[model samples]
Target: METRPLDVLNRGRDKRIVIILKNEKEITGKLQAFDIHLNMWLSDAEVSDSEVTKKYGKLLVRGDNIVCASPE
Candidate 1:
């Protein structure tokens, strides 16, 4: 059987993903949801101890803003 690249990445709910934001910041969080447009919602982010906490409930990351995403 041939495996697709997305298949490897698409581990589904609660999967950990490392997102690199456009502001040059990196966040590692659980995959919360995904829209039809492929927009991702990440929650319970594991950030640095010294990092300032975000005011938002969930991080709203644009697809284009993502530098790279990998399993954590």
Candidate 2:
């Protein structure tokens, strides 16, 4: 069987994940949903940079803004 990136993400559902955006923002949260475009929905989300951290109950991240994602 071939292993794919999305496959890895699928397996990571309901787990904590960290997303790095093109703008250099980092977000950490629980994975709730995602799509082929890499657009994602996250719960208990936190967005952070060198200066500050903000929290949200839910977050929608556009695929185009995402540089990478990994387990937290």
Candidate 3:
């Protein structure tokens, strides 16, 4: 498997992860912070065009909202 930032997203803080959110939106950024609701705080996010349409930000993503992740 390809190790990218997203892969480590579920691992917790201080870890790198690339998050692929719902609506086929991919965000490649560090896991700066998160909450109990699975909402993430990211930095250096390389979001996809689809995400732009959804108005992505600090990323209030829910666990079920996530499609996949990688460690980059």
Query: In order, what lDDT does every prediction score?
Result: 0.65, 0.93, 0.62
lDDT of candidate 1 vs native? 0.65
What would the C-alpha RMSD of candidate 2 be, to one decimal place? Answer: 1.3
Off by over 4 Å in 1: 1-3, 35-38, 46-57
Q: Select the stronger candidate by lDDT from 2 and 3.
A: 2
Tens-place lDDT per residue, model 2, 15-45, is: 9999999999999999999999999999999
Candidate achieving higher lDDT, 1 or 3 = 1
Candidate 3, after superposition: displacement of residue 69 in Å? 2.7
Among these predicted structures, which one has the highest lDDT?
A: 2
Best by TM-score: 2
Per-residue lDDT of candidate 1, residues 1-72 (tens digit): 437544545666678787666677777778887654446787876543346644344765667666667765
Ranking by lDDT: 2, 1, 3
Ranking by TM-score: 2, 1, 3
Q: Clashing residue pairs in candidate 1, if any?
A: none
Local accuracy of candidate 3 as per-residue lDDT tens digits, 1-72: 637544444565655677777877776666777654556777655667542633343554466777766655
